[model samples]
Target: MQSKDLLQLAEQFGSPLYVYDAEKIKSQYNRLTKAFSKVEKLRINYAMKALSNVAILELLRDMGSGLDTVSIQEVLLGLHAGYSPEKIFYTPNGVSLEEIEEVNAMGVQINIDNLSILEQFGAKHPNVPVCIRINPHVMAGGNTNISVGHIDSKFGISIHQLPHLVRIVENTKMNIVGIHMHTGSDILDIEVFLYAAEILFDAARNFKNLEFLDFGSGFKVPYKKDDIETDIEELGKKLSKRFNAFCTEYGKELTLIFEPGKFLVSEAGQFLVKVNVIKQTTSTVFAGIDSGFNHLIRPMLYGSQHHIENISNPKGKERFYSVVGYICETDTFANNRRIPEIKEGDILSFRNAGAYCYSMASNYNSRYKPAEVLWLEGQGHLIRAHETFEDLIKNQISLPLPAKV
Candidate 1:
């Protein structure tokens, strides 16, 4: 979207809003699919936890994408967005057996990670088809907090525990239809990912009823100009060839699946917040905004870098300013960053806000969450409205205090 278009959105929908470009999202989805066109059967499941707006879910669903959900609520959201139960893949971590059974009863594909739940669930519903999440023990990704396939990570069943997993599967007489793994986010090395895929393939040999192999996605997208990103085309070419060969060896044409969250929508999103104040300290100039960590916490939580641009004064002289938020705590988006001159009431755009931005927002400090807009075909459509005061107290029970002495 143009800077003028973004400015208009801020004016019409109010500040501290999220604007998503539908064209960008479609381009990304097409890019991934075209890269792997060689694969006979492939499934791209949009990870709903990254950004679970119903409109966004529907948008992806219309693009022939399935839903990769981690919770029952997300599964329900997918259903509400018009996704069939067969297209929804439920892969929860550390959830109760009751929740698993509930989702199973809904007819969505179930992926179990731990051994205990596998045994319990399989023993109860051996007739139900299930998927197994295996930890390849490969350390891939940019940070420890995001990586899950490491040896010590508590995400999936360890590769070393293959014997145990096989034993449980055999004892319960359960059908394993899929094998999956996710190394982490911000993965730049295709070779490391491919090596992990080899480990997953070896584990797949333990199950003869497998219908698909899910190489869980962590394909990194560029955060800033000229930043390095995953080479999906090259990775696709290499993996598709190897996958076809593996299918031949296994004596069946297995489906290749990927569960991608950020790669599909990160570049499509822009978070716009109006500058509220400018304060000059002894050592730094702070450009405080109307929003805070309550809206976008990736920076404070993950040290993420979201390129800030002064859309209000895009051609103005560049200056150094530390972008902070109105949160009561230490909420900093960028420190000593160079951007066009910013002024009070000027709208600033946070790029790469499409994934994990709005989904992670909260009502922290009793602040209202911002609205969300989708830019489709050169027009802005409001997807979520800004919170009102009544929304804050909707579920609260107000009782008169007892008279004090």
Candidate 2:
């Protein structure tokens, strides 16, 4: 999709809208799959936490993608999107064992990261297969905020506790079907990631009946011009060879799996919001937009930079403007960002918004959530409607109070 297409979407769907390109998503999926085509069995479980829109899920499902869900609701969402229970992998953290059991009852694949729940579930249901998410204690991601494999991160079971993990599995007679690790997002060093893979491989040696090894995805996507991205092709070549060798040593061919969220969808997303005001402060010139961190919090939360373009006037002379949001709080999307001159009411498109942007949005300050459009086959399809007042207060009830204590 082009800047003109995004402008058209903003006109049709209104400002502060989300538009995802179906063709971009397709090419990304195809590219990742082709990179690993040499593997006998490969599985790409689209991480639903990134962008859980039903339309997006359905699109990935149609592409023969499985789902990597962190919550029971997401597992159910996968089912709703035409995925079978077996195709869904539930990898929740810090949740009660009851919730995990509930997901398992639906026949979804179970992935446990903590010892307490692993032992609890194993003892209760020894026959049910489980995957263990291990912390290799290797930081492969770009930012510390997004990196999860460090020693202090609360994401996975520590590699040092393998003996204890094995003991629990042995005593419970649990069926161990898979081993997994996720160092973090935006992987920078392929060698560092590969080092973590070796750790996962070592961890896998403890389980003999493993069905697959999930090297959790943190592949980086370019957010701005000339920004570096993960080389999936090179990583695939090296990792595929290692995986095949491991399979030969283990006497079986195990499925290679990646739970990629951003890699598959980040570039496909574009956020369009109209310039609401041009506030000239003592020190800064603010180009305030109709949306805020409530709509896209990555900038404030993780210092993520989404390439902003003045789509309304792409050829206008460039100028530096601090892009601010409408939220009451200090929701600054960009600080002194240089772009084509932005005028009031001009539509600005934020690139690399497909993943983690819309999924993390909230009704903060009670501003209604915006609509979402799917750009497919050169046509814009409304996937989600802009929220109304009814939607904002749908779950709330007012009570007449003249208190009786």
Cα lDDT of model 1 by residue, 1-405, tens digit: 999999999999999999999999999999999999999999999998999999999999999999999999999999999999999999999999999999999999999999999999999999999999999999998888899999999999999999999999999999899999999999999999999999999999989989999999999999998999999999999999999999999999999999999999999999999999999999999999999999999999899999999999999999999999999999999999999999999999999999999999999999999999999998999999999999999999989999999
Off by over 4 Å in 1: 403-405
In candidate 2, stretches whose alpha carbon ends up further than 4 angstroms from where it belongs are 403-405
- The residue pairs found clashing in candidate 2 are none
Candidates in order have lDDT scores of 0.96, 0.93
Candidate 1 to truth, TM: 0.99
lDDT: worst 10-residue window of model 2:
138-147
Candidate 2 contains a number of clashing pairs equal to 0
TM-score of each: 0.99, 0.98
lDDT of 2 by residue, 106-192 (tens): 999999999999999999999999999999999667778899999999998999999999999999999999999999999978999
